[model samples]
Target chain A: MDYFLVSFFLIQYIRTSLQTAVNHPEWEKRLVFARYFSIAWIATFYIAEEPFWTNWVWDIFLVWLIVVIYRNEVFNSLRTTAQTVMPFVAISIIRDFVKGIFPKFYEENDSFFQVAVAFAFVLCFFVWFYARKQMKVLQKEREDRLREEQASRAQKESLEYLVNERTQELTMQKEELQRTIEELKSTQNQLIQSEKMASLGELTAGIAHEIQNPLNFVNNFSEVSAELCTELEEEIEKSELAEEDKDYIKQIIADLNQNQQKITHHGKRADSIVKGMLQHSRLSSGEKEPVEINALADEYMRLAYHGLRAKDKEFNAALVTDFDDTIGKVNVLPQDLGRVFLNLFTNAFYAVAEKKRKLAAEGFSSDYKPEVKISTKKFANKLYIRVTDNGTGMPEHVKAKIFQPFFTTKPTGQGTGLGLSMSYDIITNGHGGVLDVESIPGERTEFRITIPVSEPISQS
Target chain B: MKILVVDDEEDVKSLFEQKFRKEIRSGQFQFSFSFSGEEALTYLAAHPSEVVMILSDINMPGMSGIELLKTIRRDHPSAPPQVMMITAYGDSANHDQAMQLGADDFLTKPVNFVELKEKLLTIL
Candidate 1:
């Protein structure tokens, strides 16, 4: 009995220590230790008696109860109760039957059986506690994972919404910007066309005045030729011709030849003036080529001066030409620049001419003969040409808008103002150069054209 | 002096009439009218002495003024009538060509009659 009790206590101590290590209640181990200890004590009595009463043998039920009730690895309540009470009932029946054969060991109290039943309750509690602890830990982990998943999903949805909204805003802004650019371009083209018409109008008025001068000479010459032809014919018919008369007839012939030559010279000049006006009014294809700037300037300048002079024969201006010897040839579209220079020269002429017109109109005979100075020079990396005119100089307001399209002070249908604007486009926009103008009223109006020395990329 | 005006548009001829109103009334000038190159040639072949100069437009439908000027230069090498271009086509090519093709001068439309008259006087 002592040894059995000691063994039970040892098992109880180990189980209690292990349960404590698991951080669980140790009451189940204590209960199991007490039940097993009772079984061992009862068995010791049977052993000490040597053929102990069969009623004492009922103590063997303890081992069977432990094994059967613990089939689930936790004590089973129904099985433990069966092991304690049902076995006792069977022992009681056996004792009842054996009592008739041998009278002594038959009387058994039920309290021991009840005590075994109480152990079953403790075992059930231990089993429930163990299972509940394991389940609770697993449930907590599952809930935590679910919370993390929900949080991540919310972040993903909000981020996607933000991205979608930003894209929409960018698209709207792009559409608005495109619309504004289109509007600006349309207005710009409109202004350009208007300026073109204005300058064209001015040229037409100037051209009409230019062609009349030569025709007067033709009229006068023919009148003189008709009178001389009659005189020569009558003199030849006189039948008595003197040497002086023959000489006089020859003088008439010489006069006729001189008149014919006059008609020839002025007629060609008139034709060229009209041609220049037409060239200025025509549209350009704007193609580029390797061109001589100096010759180009001379040809157009002469034509422009003639065109202006042809309109008013007495509007004489001193033309000073300075050509840059080192200014190498550059490739350009002649038509484009021809019109540009024409505009600049003619505008210079107009400024001076306007002053001349006003002076004549105002009855000021003081000859403030106008002067136009044109010169080309080689600046670093560029060719700079300046056209300075002593004209009725522009006020600040007019100077500020010199290149603005369609803004001209001339009478309507007189100045299609596209000249300087077109020149601006050619020098700065097309060739990557600069066009600048400076003016002092009644003193000088100067236009500086800076073009790259090297040929423009498009021309090249 | 004789001045020959060549243009496809009859309006231009009448416009010239309006421009030279005084000259026509004076009967000091006798104007010959030829609508086509063949007609102008026939008039020229018969009355070459009366025609002092030809003022022709460039962009006619057929047998252009340049071609006519070339023919006149080729056929009448000596004392060929002065030919002046009077048209709207005044590009560099045309400018260079009219001078090259024996045209004494060139002008562009719409004709400034005052300039036209002076040019006529210079050659007539």
Candidate 2:
């Protein structure tokens, strides 16, 4: 009975040890050793009992335990099982033989055997609890480490995104800064150009003033001489002189007249040049007069045409006018407006004449007639004058700089280059108007003047 | 007609004399030249009866034509000669100012000798 009780307890211990081993992989080796030792003790107890049925039951239980361990995948190698179980099996079998030789001594050590089994049960319980607690801590640590890794990855991605955005923003700012720098540089150049023009205007004004005195003397003396020559010729014709002497005197008079005409023509040219420089330097004259716009335009048109014809006998262009009769008197500086009209008309004629000369040179018989057209329109509070020429129109680049002082396409002595600039100043600065040019290369160029018809602006 | 021509430019005397040679030769007119306003005033004080007309350039070195006109108007208030102001610039301010200072006529340079002769004929 005692052996049976010990064997049953041992069987229970072995079953619990095997279950613990299966549950805790970290403690599998130690728990499997305990389970095998308990199994060997149970087998020894059953073998000592000598009950055939109990022995068979124990054997079947052992086989079932092995099957359960195998199913749990914790069953160690056979050598390890033999090492843990064979020693205990050998010890218990020896104990049973000793009891068979000395039954009294074996009976007396039965309590010690029970105590060792109880101690073994306590040790297995302690080991199983310790292993379960250790496994819980290790699982918590692993979960925490995985969470930390995920957080660090997200932080790194956010930092990279921020750096990328900052780089893009910096690039945009740099481009904007570069553009602003270029704008400032251009403005500085324009300012310098204007400053240079201002100084040149002053210098030219002084030079023109100095030239005016001498020019006035030449023109006046030439006229006086011409008048004297006429008087002398009349007196000579009335006098009683030899036929040969009279003929000689007539020849001299003819020569004098021709020379006088040449002198007057060149003097007038000088006078016009001096006038241009003066007008460029002079501020707007503080005088406004009632001027007939149509008549003024017409007069200047004729003057420019005749003036060009006088210079170049070959220069001819058809002049066309479409004046608005309703456009009456406008209060302005007549001299300045006359100059503006004359400049536009002269430029128009020059353009047409040049194109005609070019066509003649090229031997083109194409009926490409050169023409200059003048048109004026009157509004309620403004006047518009349009001058158009079908000639060698200016390219875009030349047209852009046409109004700058000292900028001209004509030969140096032919043009003072201040005509359009002075006209621009007169119309815009002096008369509160606008001068605009439109052109297509090789087709035509048109200049439009728009002047306000309000209360006369006080001159500065 | 006897005229006093006042100008800063010495060449103006020959210009005027040459332009009016016919009239001068015919003894229809006598002309005197003064280089400045002071000289003209002195010539006027000396021969006031001979100078029936005074043509003066408005821009002069010491005293301007307008000043001479004012002085003549002040001194010879009742029997003042016909005073004409000539200027190189046709500025309206100078014209108006000379007119206000008792000038009889105003002309811009270079003066039209024929128009001047006609004007002188009318004045004389």
Candidates in order have lDDT scores of 0.68, 0.79
Cα misplacement distance, residue B48 of candidate 2 (Å)? 5.7
Enumerate residue pairs that collide in model 2: none
Listed in order, each prediction's TM-score against the native is: 0.36, 0.53
Model 1 residue runs over 4 Å out of place are: A1-460, B32-50, B75-79
Q: For candidate 1, give the docking quality class from DockQ.
A: incorrect
DockQ scores of the candidates? 0.09, 0.56
True contacts kept of 2: 0.73
By DockQ, the best candidate is 2
What is the alpha-carbon interface RMSD for each candidate?
Answer: 9.5, 0.9
Global Cα lDDT for candidate 1: 0.68
lDDT for position A324 in model 2: 89
Worst 10 residues of 2 chain A by lDDT: A77-86
Q: Residues A401-442, candidate 1, lDDT per residue (tens digit)? A: 878765667754457556678789988877778999998997
Model 2 lDDT, full chain set? 0.79
Docking class of 2: medium
